[model samples]
Target: MEYRPYKPVNLTAAGRDYAVAMVRRHRLLETFLVTTLGYSWDQVHDEADRLEHAASQTLIERIDALLGHPDRDPHGDPIPTVEGHTHRPAHAIRLADAAPDIYRIARVSDADPARLNRFSGHGLRPGQTVRVGEREAGELTISLPGNDQAPLVLAPEETKAIWVSPAASAGLRGPASI
Candidate 1:
């Protein structure tokens, strides 16, 4: 049997834009899943990723409205604007490098399933305050509010996936009623 290399699809500018728009929709849907539907942090990413490409713009808009125009997704990723504009925060650090103080989770990488799964187990969600307790080698031990008994330890790879801002970190200390 002759072997043939699979050729990847070439995406034009329009196609790229469509792809970004679809990603934006999926991120928004993931936010809804975590905030409204009560889906686990680890469970929503794949579901939203699949749905984002399939859902219509009208349906996405409705979901966005239902989610109350959220700015960030479940994993702290930015939700793309309806106009496709994305406003990202300036400072983002790995949980390992983060100082031992309250800080807000800004963004998280969506490429790694294992990392996301680990974060979910630690209760590390966007808009949640994380305090870095200690760093040993490339691993970080951090604590979340209301979870002081066991500090969550994360590797550098896992920490790099999470972005955060100090100013917004203050918000995580308050009630979750937002």
Candidate 2:
């Protein structure tokens, strides 16, 4: 038999269903590990990647139920539903290109673990309010909402990896709220 690489489009209905199931399991596990176990967002991906293939469907469902069937993973990526539906935000834009204003960190791509660690160290995470500052020389400045701490300067890649949505009101100066 000639060996061929599998492509997403070539999956049969059953294959697609199984793939989605695995994805849902992986993402749910990632969320559970981070929120319930105190694992950092960047740390859960590898663990989930290892466990997802080994966990049974029953085990995955139990984990999902225990986590209240979370909609988003630790990194703010949407989890595919058992029915294969996803709820991605339509207005999410790259932090680098976002207009200077108040915005909520919607999602941070977990493609780079190092960048993820840096973001977490700077207290940047999903749902946090931030004030977008000036963009210059391929870097973007952002300040925590209402915090006196110095604004964090992020490289274009760093900023681009983050997604944001308009925040009702976030300012460079004000009281900080988690």
Candidate 3:
């Protein structure tokens, strides 16, 4: 239980293990809720938050097995393995930082439910391919597959809230798995 003044504290080995276990529980619950229970990405956080504290390890493991050991949640965040290993997408970049090209949606921040709902309304979810156009006036223009090539004008917050990777690098064809 030692910490430096005015510095971010690093977790001890035991603390890290506990944190990882909780994260595993929460993420497994989130994936189960989304994949099995038909819950949307935006709706699983609160439910997972409540359930993570109460869910037993056996239950979480069962849920993970039922999911066929998915490595990512609905929002594309990596799910830690039983050994506490996390595999992050090596090439993921912020949507704001992406060059003008076609890219697969790698991840989206679930921090803002209203914004998440808006994104969902626009059919912007993980694994969806989007065409990133040039940025203008502090906003970025992005286009989906349909919509007659109309661009979705997004503020900086919207752009920063998403993550994308080279669509070709991942071998993701026509909006692959979520």
Candidate 4:
């Protein structure tokens, strides 16, 4: 696609392409940050967001190869395909409505840094199994895979942002499992 600036003349087609490419890189980088580098889910977005626009295609490819071609980022957002296409599955669910038990957190909205931090503090991460213990009007109390005490509570907004997969019996692990 020919690059065209979205609004202000300060933007150029090259700049637009760069921006799109950066966004793509950022999502892929998030996957690497959490899975390979041991970065907390909350810690990767800002750094990746900054680097995405600046990184070379070569660099991004290297990271992608290292991460084994992850399809989703740390927040469960889709990573853009190399050709710039994004394939996102529609599986979002509210934490408040989820049954009280173990399930896999598939994705979360990364728009709020503070919310992401709160999720990480409570041990919520993509692919990790979590047990919902209680549900209030606007919040869900959850237990991490290995933790005994429940320290994670998702507010209505946060709960709405999180996407989960139904937990299979084989995937249940109590606190200390992760």
- Candidate with top lDDT is 3
lDDT of 1 by residue, 11-99 (tens): 77777778778878888888888788888777887888788778888988899898888777776777778777777777776655677
Question: What does candidate 4's lDDT look like per residue over 37-155, in tens digits?
Answer: 89877788887877877778798899999988878887877777777777654554656578776678877788888888877777676777777777767677776755777467767
Error of model 2, residue 168, in angstroms: 5.3
Task: Please report, as a residue range, the 10-residue window in candidate 1 with the lowest summed lDDT.
Answer: 169-178
lDDT of candidate 2 vs native? 0.83
Model 2 C-alpha lDDT per residue in residues 17-42, reported as the tens digit of each score: 87888889889999888888999888
Which stretches of model 3 miss by more than 4 angstroms? 172-178
Question: Which segments of model 1 are wrong by more than 4 Å?
Answer: 1-13, 112-114, 167-178
Superposed Cα deviation of residue 27, candidate 3 (Å): 1.1
Best TM-score goes to which candidate?
A: 3
User: For model 3, how does the per-residue alpha-carbon lDDT over 13-87 read when each residue is reduced to its tens digit?
Assistant: 989988998988888899999889999888999999999998887899899899999988888888899999999
RMSD versus native structure for model 3: 2.9
TM-score, candidate number 4:
0.68
lDDT at 176, model 1: 50
Error of 2 at 14 (Å): 3.5
lDDT of each: 0.73, 0.83, 0.87, 0.73
When 2 and 4 are scored with lDDT, the better candidate is 2
Q: What TM-score would each prediction reach against the true structure? A: 0.73, 0.85, 0.91, 0.68
lDDT of 4: 0.73
